[model samples]
Target: MEIISKLSILIVILFISCHSGRGNVDVQQSADSIAVCHIGAIPSRFTALHKDTLSYEKGEDNVRMVFIRGGKFKMGSTDFVDAQPVHAVEVNSFYMDEHEVTNAQFEAFVKATDYVTVAERPLDPKEFPGVDPAMLVPGSAVFTNPSKVDGMDNFLQWWQYVPGANWRYPEGPNSSIRGKEDHPVTQLAYEDAEAYAKWAGKRLPTEAEWEYAAKAGNHTSETYYWGSEKKENGKWLANIFQGDFPMKNTKEDGFETTSPVKSFPANAYGLYDMEGNVWEWCSDFYRPDYYMQSPKSNPKGPSSSHDPQEPGLVKRVQRGGSFLCNDEYCERYKAGSRGKGEVNSPTNNVGFRCVKDI
Candidate 1:
């Protein structure tokens, strides 16, 4: 496989958290202050939903959503080549999930549809013509830490393709999500996320929509969802790596892997895990230079995917950072940073939430 292809596979596996500091407050206390609106119980019109608080929920699983009253904002950043050429863009108002889709919520969808995720299917030999059929077993990528590594370039050093690894078995066949139903669902490919969205009567957010909501109507150029600072008054606002990447995790955020949804305080618009939890799949195709040709109002992403590093493979945009993100290496936890993965590749670290048109 090409380097980019390898990187995409590794991205899925590396998906992998924090704590009290100055101005420390209990998480439960913070949640109690925010009002949660339930879907179906609230007005069906977008304007009505927008008038209420920015958060909503529905179904037995309580799929929470937050309304984003969108407008013009600068998209992209100059810090990275792909995020370069920052430009102004506008998006209409919409409702977004308050947190990443939880395992319980996805389970409800699967039970209703009897759906099987892409990760559960065996690989097709035609896709890898020269590969031995023996290696084509069904599986998804899972993260494993080596004692040490030379550098981040060799992703295979930390990522392993384990048979029987899927959403329910995030680590592999031996692992299970028995008590982690509230945690974000993982090992999901792009199609898997889209399938759940369709079943829930929602859709994945566009890159522009995701970015706009992440900004939370701030409109000002900022590095994080909360503000320019990564932490607030010494408190770790989001779940992200606190120690060495792919080796040691300090667990300062009270979680070493995926935490339950709403473990941290929500953003200004009441969206949780917008910075770090799992990288979310966007509706648009990936393109490094899409910002240059992006529209001023409600820009969807590029018409088709294109990654110069691996042009042959189709990819989609993955926003937000994940639990594995760290400042030393994968600084993607930053709000404006961007990531991409192959459409069919699934990993323990990759998951998604949904959005409604209203």
Candidate 2:
């Protein structure tokens, strides 16, 4: 079935019938001479699994939305090697969160709504009884220097899996969100973000809307959300790694960790942290070649597929860049350079905002 670009709101329920499977797979050159799997393989069992149901229930409280006018713009990148073959895309008007969900907001949602984050819970033993206890620890990704590096790259050197580092405890067991309410909440999985959106009468923006908003009407191809220039008047526009990634960060932005959502200037649309801070989650399943087949109007994503590159068969899209991003490696600050992450995966540098139909 060909994926259609319609304005009608639908509840997309991802159905996993079988756990073991492989779709269209291709070997592509990744950074540091590593050939990784580029997962965009359309499955043969493609069918209308289910439509997206109502996002928000009735009578949700304390939810805010930012009105975004829809328009036509180039969706992909022409500069990045992976973001090749830019294409035109059109979308309808929608409402999105003013900023990435903050710690205060997330705490309020959990306290009032009695929501339990995925990381806080334990894995179902029936699914994988032989799972390692260490791997199943309740936690999310944390940014920490490796104890001993055996020449693996800088990006790998900085990311560590700290136990008890979920949304409540951002920096593992020892750290907490106390006194840091304004900071954008990290260590949230895609499921956690979706739950909050549903509780707040909103939904996560599709990858298309996220990119369009980042563009902010700049028809010219640019590297960052702000502009082609790296800085403005000798000032850093966004929070990124400097003075060598992983090993040494000068904290040039006056932050060793996450900064406030609006610490940097807004894009042309007045949206802050659209390029820096933390990566935002989108509703689309990542496909590097989706631009080639995506509809010119309101494109969602591929009909169905399995990304072999990921640890398992999870489908989702990650947008914007995180604080760990630098020019030396993982130059994903560009609006078009896409990062493919699993739907259930959680990391310290990954957070999400919300969106709704206008």
Candidate 3:
């Protein structure tokens, strides 16, 4: 419900839902959420995707997927509740996209299949009993800077549903991705990512695989992707929020919102933006307690999903962090930290990459 004004959804679809079908949408206060968001469908022109993401060179469409040799490492973090128990997890070697999927690459898939994303569709009025049908237009949650702040408890201060705010028109229908084709596609639901994965001959990585990949085959267990400090040589190492949350961004990483896929350096596995940029989707269904019983070898997460907050909907795991993450608010940019969202929800900051069996 998080984007459409569900009263129950913060548009988690911003994925900030208002209140409607799945009721009592609580303020999502976490490292994963920038303000509050929801998934929405906002259609764009066909020619939009064909723009040159290759400005990054190597044709972002052909950007090489990295080969990650797998092994065991501590899978969860000590601080977060869901990531606790620090279990040992081993995964098989796999091929992972060196970076998140870009707008240009997604355009190719859309062009090839004429596929439509969830946010591009209209809302089913059956889901909302008392709301005006006219309000249920295609849209997604977007982070708007609040003019003033009484407190951070209410995400509605910055997150809202913007009609026609799909991946192409990230901010809304009037916005354009013309020069930002190289940025990871946003406003995508898990199903959208899955559809794209199927078309691309790949699949989303399992949570174990994703964590292992982020760890880059156990390069370090320090929890920090690049060790203790957030900066390397006095320069920011990854793309994360460096100022006040939902209000101000210092743009310390040379980016205010989403940046080009390879704008930051890669990990030990030759993977770029694994720690920050945008939250990448993982294949596993999310269960906060899954780690307690997770298998030691190639764990595939829980059989079903559960989130006490949004108990009515199923949620999938999202990893890495967005530009909204910072020590002041979201610290999910830390390695092994986890994010979860309603399965159908998409947001401006939430995007995904893919992986495959080797």
Candidate 4:
């Protein structure tokens, strides 16, 4: 309901795109027209192919996972202030989803449990003391970029709350996910993600587990999961915005919004969509200075949450970037960069994968 004021300041300005009423159609066309040379599938010779590594599938959902061997690696980054103090962290072997959860998978869970996402529920009057009861309608934040804008200070210019906007109707009541079941499910609040994870007998990854898995045990201060370079021989490795932020997307990666998971190459650990597509939910609470006191082995993130920009709200860690991320404005697609979102606020650019501890 009334999704404004529910987002963190950074999330508010993180990413936006131009909306042309039929925006999704035009963007999808642009993506389809791009002549991208696809990379070959993961090779069997990779290190993750060990016999001890586990892979599993369950139910009609058919979610697949890859075994990530535990090891010590230097986490965080020197480039961003929040990811500073590059510290050492080690995680035990765990099974991680090969791709982000898809709409088909989420639909299966919802059908089995009749689960209602937070965005689908009515807004409690007690949560907003002074707001008019008439304005408190169930809804979620949807991206709606203007054709052009003068400044970025006002986030409401690009994001709006529309009733009937949920994972099924990402853009609003008018949009549908009919042919896009393979695409990553969006408009999920933290509780929605957690609920899905629990039903699937998995849990959201810790900040440490996420970083370690992304690094794929080949950590060397690389800017991206594949390597230090954003582009490999003039090829896009992830689905990030390729043009002006909040104005245009070149669709160089064959996606205008969320791509079908694994549309691009997987990381060294055989994980897909690790760097871009959508910001993924992490189990840990958010704290800018948590790295300073993080434990050497298996750091699970801060015990409590804190964001100076929005002190009253509880925030959780959101890893990777989204299709809206561009180097010109938001360079969050780089490895070790950090993002946070209010636990109850579901935006179009956020989704999540799950992990199971061995």
RMSD to native, candidate 3: 7.2
Write one digit per residue (lDDT tens) for candidate 4, span 225-267.
6786777778788889887767777788777888888888888
Query: Over all chains combined, what TM-score does candidate 4 have?
Result: 0.83
What's the lDDT for all of these models?
Answer: 0.70, 0.65, 0.72, 0.72
Q: Which pairs of residues collide in candidate 4? A: none
Candidate 2 structure quality by residue, lDDT tens digits, 5-50: 1100010112111011112223232222321111111111122111
Q: Model 3 — TM-score against the truth?
A: 0.85
TM-score of each: 0.81, 0.81, 0.85, 0.83
Cα error, residue 78 of model 3, in Å, equals: 0.6
- In model 4, the runs with Cα more than 4 Å from the true position are 1-60
Which stretch of 10 consecutive residues in model 4 shows the poorest summed lDDT?
35-44
Residue pairs with clashing backbones, model 1: 15-349, 16-323, 18-252, 18-253, 18-254, 19-252
Ranking by TM-score: 3, 4, 1, 2
TM-score for model 1?
A: 0.81
TM-score of the candidate numbered 2? 0.81
lDDT of the structure predicted as candidate 4: 0.72
Instruction: Give a tens-digit lDDT track for model 3, residues 1-358.
Output: 3434453252332232311111122323223333232333222211223222212211124658898887878888765656777888788899999999999999987776667777777666666567677777777777778868888667667777778878889899888889998999998888788877776777899978888887865545675776778888888888887777667777878998899988877878899888878888888987767887898999988889776655656678888878777765667667777777666667888899988898
**Of the pair 3 and 4, which is ahead by TM-score?**
3
Worst 10 residues of 1 by lDDT: 35-44
